[model samples]
Target: MLRDKIINAISEVGFDEYKEISSADIIFADAVFASCKANTCGNYGQNHSCPPLSGDMDTNKQRFLNYDHAIILNKIMFLGEYYEKMESSMTEVFELLDRLRDQLDDEPVMIAGPGGCNLCDECSAKTSEVCRFPDQKRYSMEGSGMDIVTMSRGLGMTYNAGDNKVGFFMMVLY
Candidate 1:
């Protein structure tokens, strides 16, 4: 089936855990979710893939709803004793996501990665400039108002793997 093909592609790209879910099964976007990013995450205006830069909450939600299906991809990695390796881990996960996207021949695929766009060492948004890698930049699922924890639970996926174990989530929508 097509879902199996997508899952195979994900595995080829090095993601071992994934689920194919109808877009209808996804939890609806909520503006309050976006507020969490701006209020606490501190990447609100720092990255093109984040809020205020990604798009308005309503627009992001509508864009997401336009897709009929999605593949939720995940990777489990050691987060170190105190999460010092977070940045490197996030970048690696997104690189795997990029490879997964390349394997999909389907048109109109949108990928919402685990964190803000880390395409560059420093975001151009910090310099008051537009994104330098618009084609490569990845928005976070949360940045688009997704409640990933709830979504994962709804999909029968484990959100928290364990202590010192970090799980990255990305969605390939088409």
Candidate 2:
């Protein structure tokens, strides 16, 4: 039943393609984090929710390695309108993830979204406070130092502009 829900959620997404990942698809996620810190985005320091504050990437990947199997959710939406469309796209991703979360019987499902989790308008981590959603909050694959485009390639999903410009993510169930 849970697998059915996962599949159902996948179907509900407006995805152009998908592919299962192999070890080759994975890379040095640490490099991704380095890039994020070196140059990119605003939430870097001000938000405790961003990288550096998020902790070690190598450690995180090791944690992921322990998992049995992970599904790559490649969802595409409007990059034309920028932030507005980005939020809308993430909302869809979260809804589908919630569906999977609900249907899970005993399996532990961990989600790595395309970008930062905007579930809460303001992240509680800003105050050095505990995450409001220990059970629900999803960390972005990028946030965890993952290279989504390369990961998608391993999954047989392309990330070309114009034709399909969706961000990629990870959903592991064990």
Q: Report the number of the highest-TM-score candidate.
A: 1
- What TM-score does each of the candidates earn? 0.83, 0.74
Quote the lDDT for 60 in model 2: 57
Model 1 C-alpha lDDT per residue in residues 57-160, reported as the tens digit of each score: 77777877898998887788778889998878876877787787678746557888866777688999889898887777777787777777778887777677
Residue-level lDDT of model 2, residues 11-121, one tens digit each, is 665455544444334554666877778645565643443587666876656645766556676655655544456656667767766665565535555656555666677
As for candidate 1, its clashing pairs are none
Which 10-residue window in model 1 sums to the lowest lDDT? 30-39
| Top-scoring candidate (lDDT) | 1
Lowest summed lDDT across 10 adjacent residues in model 2 is found at 16-25
Model 2 bad stretches (over 4 Å): 1-5, 12-14, 22-25, 46-49, 81-84
Clashing pairs in model 2? 19-155, 76-166
What shift in Å separates residue 99 of candidate 2 from its native position after superposition?
Answer: 3.8
lDDT score for residue 122 of model 1: 90
